[model samples]
Target: MGKIKKRLKNFKAPDALLLICILMAMVSILTYLIPAGEYTRFLDPETGKEMVDPNSFHYIENTPVGPWKVLSSVHQGLVESAGITSFLFIIGGAFGVLNSTGALEALISRTATRLKGKEKLVVIFFVTLWALGGAFLGNFEECLAFLPMQITLCLALGFDSITGVVIGICGVAVGYIGGVMNPFTLGISQQIAQLPPYSGIGFRLVLWLATLTVTIVYIYRYADKIHKNPQLSLSYEVDKASKYREEISSNIEFSIRHKLVLISFVLAVIGIVYGVIVFQFYLGEMAAVFILLTIVMACISDKPVNETVNAFVNGAADLLYPCLCVGFARGLTIIMMEGHILDVIVHSLTGVLGKLPSIVSAPLSFIVISIINLFVPSGSGKAVIVMPILVPMADVLGITRQTVALAYHMGDGITNLLSPAEATIMVALGLMKISYGKWIKWFWKLVLLWYLIGIIACIIAVNIGFGPF
Candidate 1:
């Protein structure tokens, strides 16, 4: 008894990778316990997206997964990650090349220097912009461009990397959750459900404001805490090097070459925004743009071609862990699908909604999408998979599709800040050198608060009949 008690007392939280592995194991075990089931899926002729038929769920026999298959899912996840993983590497390498040329440091230092006295204002300003970008544009990967500057800016402002993570990553995440005019989640879901495009903008804007205000307050409190006592930061032990970052930024003179390089970098970001909005390009095209910018930056900075290549490789290598985490975490979904248990879970949850009161079930839709997001992280993709079923279901229950959209946004959007399968969260934590556990330690409370607020918002929406109907 003493031995067991001592072991429990001394137990350490598993590292991120280990936690993923354990979750995978637990999921594999569940395949045997939960009967394998599925819903009928058909290709939507109009949108060309596959969608599930809610009424078609039924169990199949003898679909238990073996240890070997479960283990192999890790590799399968990597294979599935070719698009996202490659995008991360390319972006990391692009930033790496810029860093090698001293241009990156110059850019950050200039901003930090300019914002010296208005540090808190700087945070609020960028947080608002990032939130707006996320709300309106559904900008996730495109926002990675600002991370280098944001991190250095945090160091210069006398806060640790946590603040930077909050500003850069959390800022956009909250905006994405707002989904007011976001094309990917709200827009796509509305279109597929045959609703007017951008319907519910007023409601969503209100959501954005409420959520963003809370988010700003949440982040500001933490920023103020670290400012008062740096030791209070989640990344404090790792923050000693912050001064070195400051020193590096401090000494650089922002030379003419650096200025030109900075201009080129700015053009690259503009080009990215254009590509996303106009061209509607994705991973491969975006990666190509970064590559082009990298080569251009290296040449203008007078870096030797071979040395530039090495630097890019090294930079991408640093980010490989998070990219790999993305794939590894995806293995959980692959295992669930392979065992045919994914549909069972979805069906079970959605089916339960019919039994509860509209007030109760309406808000619980947020939880529904939140649970689904763990298995499927892509917002547009999730919209395709879920909105079809949820749209019809909402009407049947005398609830509005707009409210379901809100629930879906709250579920799929906010959870990305912590979901293992979310590339944004993984990439941010990887870049900031903060462990997944530390991020959860620092940010989970706010997420819980956000969850409560979302529930309340949903209840209010149902009560007021918030809709285009």
Candidate 2:
């Protein structure tokens, strides 16, 4: 027993999968302790969207998940999350086909060689590009398609996978926080709150600029540190073992095939943006674009049909573990859902936060929303769940609905990278081979910094009456 106790004491560093399972178990247990409750959902006639009626929350029968259900929920989680898991697999397979042609490696090598002394500029450009995509296009899962290429680019530029993650995940994260014109969060949120769409642009632009600047600086500093001393990087060991094809000659020629493949990739990105903006493309449409791009890229690189098929299969196989992470991470939410405790937690949060003074409540809303986002990672989904309650609460607390909206936006964005249940983040970490524990160790400080910025922004919004109302 002493030996077992000693072993337990020494146990450390659970991986993403284990961490997710642990979370599922904890949430399952909470189903009993925390009474099951739900808010009556009503459809907004004007917006034709469902909104949770905050005042209608009432205790319901507890449906606690047993140990067997905890295990079964993992499979149920995968089934429920089939859309995203399959999306990950398809993206993985598509990149698999692309990688087999060596076009991505060749492009990275050529670009890295030419910009050897200008790595800082490259990081800034890509980060800004990703931020714009997120801010304007409401990109979240869409960014998954580019992780392999992004990670390769970072490695080629003498940075680690975490650097790539920051550029992609954190950059987009700040953009989501900014919500300058993000239809997903900002638009859905304002509509639910019965405010004009994109109504508070002036202040939102400021919020965007502040968050973007800090993010850029933070990423640059980290990249600079890791560049100066590789050992300083949290991802140093995992990155060292990464199969990034670093030995590729920098002087490798950018042949016609490589150029064609790269051009096709560029066109594919443009297509995705246009589709999203003009036609309201979601996962299905985006996946189709990637599927087509995969074929175009393979054809351009002159990969034989059989070879391409094999490469695609192998590539998809390589990502099997990471894709599984997505499903397992979803199981956390599934457990909470099966146990019927999600709304109870949401109702509890709003109930507590509603009692605070506006001055205190406005900023604290960020914290409350951050906690709530752990259970509901979907931006639009959370907006529906919390906005109805927050809107009325804001009126009583003498704060603008816009302030609460801002709180929702910033809190949701910041925690996306931090939430273990966020499938996209888990998938990104898996692709980079970074453990969730390591990511948190490296990322918690940045999250704190972002929270500070967000809280200050919320306070200012409250003071300035940031609204067109």
- The most accurate candidate by TM-score is 2
Cα-based lDDT at residue 463, candidate 1: 94
- Candidate 2 regions with alpha-carbon error over 4 angstroms: 1-11
Global lDDT of model 2: 0.84
> TM-scores across all candidates?
0.94, 0.96
Error of 1 at 32 (Å): 0.9
Worst 10-residue lDDT window, candidate 1: 241-250
Clashing pairs in 1: none
Mark the regions of model 1 whose C-alpha exceeds 4 Å error after superposition. 1-11, 241-244, 248-251
Q: What lDDT score goes with residue 294 in model 1?
A: 87
TM-score of 1: 0.94
In angstroms, how far off is 105's CA in candidate 1?
2.2
Per residue, candidate 2 scores C-alpha lDDT tens digits across 305-413 of 9999888788778777777887888888888888889998888888888788888999999899999998899899899998998999899988988888889988899
